[model samples]
Target: MARAETRTHPDTADAALLEGGRVGLSGRWTADQGAAVEDAAARIAGSAAGAPILVDLSQVSRLDTLGAWVLERTRAEIEAAGGRLAYAGAAPEHRILLSEVKLRAAEPAPAPRGRLYGFLEDLGKRVVGAKSDLVTGLAFFGEVVTACIRVAARPGTFRGTALVNQIEQVAFRGVPIIVLISFLVGGIVAQQGIFQLQRFGAQSFVVNLIGLLILRELGVLLTSIMVAGRSGSAFTAEIGSMRMREEVDALRVMGLDPIEILIVPRILALVIGLPILTFLASLAALAGGGLTASLYGGMTVDAFLARLQAAVSLHHVAVGLIKAPFMALIIGIIATIEGFAVEGSAESLGRHVTASVVKSIFMVIVLDGLFAVFFAAIDF
Candidate 1:
C-alpha cells in the first residue's frame, strides 16, 4: 500500500495537491483546528469545482467530529458546484466516524425561489387563509347557535352564574368608558349640528338632527365599536390562553363540549348585555346633547326635551336597540373563533386577540350597513 504523502501547495500552505487527481489533507484537524479546517475545506471545495476529485485524509494524524463535519461540508459544497468527491484510503477507524458525521451533516438547503414565484406563492397562501377564516367563522356561528338551542331546551343546564359573570365583565365593567365616550360623541354631534343649522336659520332643528343621528345610527355604532375593542379582545385572550394551556382539551376529554363550557355563556351575556349598554349609551348621549343645546344653542332644558321628544320616536330607539343583539352575536362569535384558533404560544394569543377585535369591528360596520339597507327597503 502506498502511504499518502502530504505537502503544502507552493502558493497556499493550507492546501496541497497529489497524484491521481487526489487532494491531500494534513495536520491535527481536531476541534481546535475548526477555523483553519473550515478555511482549508473551502479552498479544497473551490479547487474541485466543475471536476471530479479524490481526497486523501490518511495524512491527518489526529481528527475529531468537528473536523469530520468540516470535511462533510466541503464535500457538499463541491457537489453543489457540480463536482464529485471521493475519499482516497481513509483509515478504517476514521471511515466509520467520517461516514457518521457526513450522514448527520447532510442537511438540505432551502431552494432559491424567484421574486415572481415568491409573490405568487404568498398571494395564494393569503387567498387560502381567507377561505379558511370564512369557513371557520361560519362553523363557529353554527356551533354557537346549536349550543344556545341545546341549553335553552334544558333550562337546568343553563349556566346562569357564568352568564351573569360575563355580563358584569363585558357590560357593567364597561359602563364608565361607555358613558364617557357617548357623552363626548353626543356633545360633538350637537355642536356640529348647531353650527350647521344656525347658518341655515334652522338652529332648532339641530335638536332633531342630534336625536335622529344618535338614536338611529351613532349610538349603537359607537357602543359596539367600544365593546368590540374592550371586551371582544378579552374574550379571545382568555379563551386562547385556555387553549394554549390544554384546558380545552381537558374539557373535551372529560366529555364536556368546549363551546358549551367556554362560549355559550359569553354569547348569551353579549346578547343580553349589549342592549342594556346601548340603551344606557343612548341616554348618556341624549344628556350630552341637552347640555350642548343649553350652552351652545342657547336653548332651555325644557325646550331641548320637547324638541327631542318630538324628533325621536320609539321606532328610532327600537331600531338602534334591535341591532344590538345581532352586533353582540357578531362580536362574540368572532372573538370565540379567534380564541379557539390559538396555537401554543404567547405570540399566537396576542395575534388572535388582535384579529378578533379587527374582525369584530369590521363585521359590526358591515352588519350595520346591511341593517340600514334593509330598514330603508322595508320603510322602517
Candidate 2:
C-alpha cells in the first residue's frame, strides 16, 4: 500500500491533494483541533466539485468522535450537492467511528395555514371555552346553594356583620349614582315621548309611557347593570386579592368553609340590597318623569299623577322586582367565579376583575331578556 503524506502543523488537521484525485488528511483530527478539523473537512468536500474524491486517512496522527462526525457531515453535504466522496486507508477504530456517526437530515418546515382555517380554529377554541365556563358557573352555583343551606341549618354560622357591611358598600353607597342616572334617563325618556306623541295630539299619553317603561324595564335593568359594574367588580377584586395572598387556603387550613365565611355574606348582601335599590331607582325615575312632564310637557302634577296611577299596575312593579334577586345572584356568582380563578399575579387579578364585570353585565342583560320573553308568554 502506498500511503499518502501531507506536510502540516502536528497539532491541527490539514487536507491536501494527492495522486488520482485523492485527498490526504494529516496531523491530529480531534476536538482539541476544533475549527481546524472542520476547515479541513470543508476543503475536502469543496475539492470534490462534481467528481469522485478519495480521502486517505492513513496519515492522520489522531482521530476523535467530533472529527469523524464533521467529516461525515461534510461528505453528506457534498453528496447532496451531486458530488461523490469515498474513504480509504482508515484504521479499524476510525472506520467504526465514522460508521457510527451518521448525520440526520433536517426536518422540513410546516406549511402555512389559510385565513379560513385560522378563523375556524379560533372559533372552535372560543366555543369550547364558553362551554367550560358554563359548566363551571353551574357547579359554583351549586356550591353556593349548599353553603347557604348549611348556614340556614346552623343560623349561628351566618356572618351578620359582614352581610351588613357588604350591604352598606353595595347598596347604601351606590344610592346617589344609581338615583341620579335613573332620574336623568327617566327625564330624557319622558321628554322624547312627549315630543313624539305631541304630533298625534296625544302628549297626555307620555305619562302612561313613562310609568310602564320605567317600572317594567328601565328601572331594574339599569340598577342591575350599575351594580354589576360597581359592586360586582369590587367583589372580584376583594376576593382575588385574598386569593393572591393565600388567605383562602389559610381559611381552609383553619377548618372553616371559605364559601360560608366570605362568599355567602357577599351574595346575601347583594340579594338583600338589590331589591331595595331597584325600588329606590324606580321611585326616583318616576319622580324625574313627573318633573319632566310638568316642565316640558306643560302637564300639571295632579294630572300626571292621575295618568300614572291609571296606567301602571301592581303587575308591572312585581315583574321588575321579581328580576332583582336573580340578577343579583348572577352578578355575585360571576364575580366570585372570576375571583377564585385568579392566579398569583397583579395582572391576573386585574384581568379577572375586568372579566367579572363584563361577564356579569352581559349575563344580566341576557337574564332580563329571558324574563321579558317569559313574562310576555305567560301574560304577566
Candidate 3:
C-alpha cells in the first residue's frame, strides 16, 4: 500500500505507433473489443505507408469465445484497411474453427436429375394401364345392353323432356357442323368419283360411287372422328372433374354404381347419338352430291337421286349402323377409363382428356378395320 505501482495500458500506447503497421493485445478481450480494433484500424488506414496490423494470439492461451471473436474481428478490419494481417502463430484449434465456419457457410448441393427419363417412362406406363383398363371395361358391355333393353321395355325412359336436352346436344348442336362437313366432303368425293367413273364412260355411276362410299365408310368414320374430338373429350373432362372433386367417391359412398350410373348413360347416349347423327350426315352428303352433279357434271337432281338409290345397297346401310354403335362404345369406354384414371389435379385432367381423344380415334379406326374384315369374310 505504501508503494505506488505504475502499469501500462498496451492498447493506448500501441494506438499511436499502429498508424504505420502494428497491433497490440496485452489483456483478455471480449466481443466488445471489436470497436477498439476497428477504431485503431481506421487511424492506421490514414497513415502514410499504411501497413497491415498483425495481432499476436500466441499469448491468448485462456481465450473465451468472445475473446476469440474479438481477435477474428481485429484481423479482418486490419486486412480490409489495405494492410496484411498475418497470424504470428496459429493453434490447431484455430484451424479447426476456420474450417468449421467455412463448412457452415458453404452452399447446398443441387438435386439430382438422373432419374428424369425413368420418371417419364413410368408416366407412359400409367397411360398404357389406363388404356388397358378401358379395353377390359368392355366386359361390362353386355350388362349395358341389358340395362338399355330394360329401359326400352318400359318406354317411360324415352320421355320427351329427358331426351330433348340430349337430342339438342346430340342432334341440333351436331347438325350444322355435320351438314357443313358432309357437304364439302361429298363434293370432294363426287369430284374424285367422276374421274374414275368417267374412265369407264360411266359418269352416271358417280352417284352410285359417292352414295356407296358415304354410307359404308364416311358415315361411320367421319361420325366417329367428330364424336371422338367432341363428345369423347367431354366425357373425360366431366368424369375427371368429378373424380377430382371427390364426387365419384360420394357416389360410391351412396352405394351408386359409377359404371351403371355414369358410364352406361354416356355410352348409351353416344351409341344412340352417333347413329342418328350419321343418318342425318348421310342425307346432307347426298344433297351435296346432288348439287355437285347438277352444277358441274350436267346431271339433273332426279337422275342423281335415282343413280344413288341404285348404287347403295341395304346391306351397306345396315353395316354402317352396326359400325356406329360399336364406334360409340369404344369412344365412351376409352373416355370414361381416362376420366377414372385421373389423379386429383388440373394437369392430370387435361392429359387424360387428350389421351381419351387419341385412344378413341385409334380404337374407332381399329374397330372399323375389324368390321370391314368381318363383313368381307361373311360376304355382307
List clashing residue pairs in candidate 1.
Answer: none
Clashing pairs in 3: none
Question: lDDT: which candidate is best?
Answer: 2
Decoy 2 TM-score against native: 0.75
Top TM-score model: 1
Candidate 2 local lDDT, 205-321, one digit each (tens)? 998898989898899999999999999999999999999999999999999999999999999999999999999999999999999989988999999998899999999999999
Candidate no. 3 TM-score: 0.62
Candidate 3 deviant stretches above 4 angstroms: 1-135, 139-164
All candidates in order of lDDT, best leading? 2, 1, 3
The TM-score-based order of candidates, best leading, equals 1, 2, 3
lDDT of 1: 0.87
For all the candidates, what are their Cα RMSDs to the real structure?
5.1, 7.2, 13.0
Tens-place lDDT digits, model 3, residues 145-171: 666676668665444454455556655
Backbone clash count, each prediction separately: 0, 0, 0
Residue-level error in angstroms, candidate 3, position 311: 1.5
TM-score, per-candidate, Cα-based: 0.81, 0.75, 0.62
